[model samples]
Target: MAEQINLDKDDLITFFIHHLDKVYSAKSHLLKRLPEILYQVHFSDLEEAIFETIKVVELQRKRMAAIYELMGALKNEGSISGLTGLIDDSFEEIKTHQDNPELRDMSILFYMTNIEATEIASFQVLQLLAVKIRKERIKELIKENYNEAKADKALMLLITTKYLSTV
Candidate 1:
């Protein structure tokens, strides 16, 4: 079976927005509780990194929203062509962290968000570049990754709850 992408930006945005919206909600909740988790960790200089990360996320959210309106316009349509930049920007956001486990976890979360973005965008690419790409293969891959993330999320929630209770 071949999936054809006729350049429907509204559809693409809707697809991406569904995943991104969930991530934004989860991150917003986590951000509100970050202070409690990091009370013992130094955040003086890291405030800038947090600020930059927030800005990028905000911008990315807006971009996902604007993608619909951007579809039919010439200048705004350029946004679709700049998908690589969005991916690269996401990668750059995580590059600020070193080897710290907590930071690594945060970076991985950021990467996961980008993965959602790319997975949605890649649909069009797959349609164009590799129409024969097996749907089952992609579905299986996504399911495996999703299951791992779900397990990790559950463990994190348990640990965080315990830590908060002790605080």
Candidate 2:
């Protein structure tokens, strides 16, 4: 069972800002982890894809910073506990597959796809908030971030199905 919560306009705005903070935190956390994950990945194309995505992630972080500036909510601190927990779980999963390169690569790809999904969902929510608040530039920025996440997900799927095929 679950309880329903009600929020006024101001509360909604605050909640939105909090989520933006969490998105920023998630990006920051990924930036820190990507290099370590990249080192473990053996495929050249997948490695290149991750290297390119690092640049995109940096840009997304800057865009989030701009949004915070726009909303005058730069000081807000938020928890990205879900993303952090996912990353922690991924590390444990990677450890279990260390003796097998194929399994490790597959694990990493699946983990990245999950991360991309989370980023896409987060950006979508941000886009909705931007529209509701009439922040056209912010909405556009969030859309671009969402598109990058989708592309990253597609790349992971392609690598998993095409390059890593066991058949």
Instruction: Provide TM-scores for the models.
Output: 0.29, 0.89
Candidate 1 local lDDT, 38-144, one digit each (tens): 33233332333344444444544444344323333222222322443454554455556554645644554455445444444543443332223333443343344
Identify the leading candidate in terms of TM-score: 2
Which ranges in model 1 have alpha carbons more than 4 Å from their true place? 1-17, 24-43, 71-167
Report the lDDT of model 1 for residue 117. 46
lDDT of 2 by residue, 45-73 (tens): 77888888899999988888887788787
| Deviation in Å, model 2, residue 110 alpha carbon | 0.5
Candidate 1 TM-score versus the reference: 0.29
Candidate-wise lDDT, in order? 0.41, 0.81
TM-score of model number 2? 0.89
Model 2 misses residue 65 by how many Å?
A: 0.6
Listing every candidate in turn, what is its Cα RMSD in Å to the true structure after a full C-alpha superposition?
Answer: 13.4, 3.4
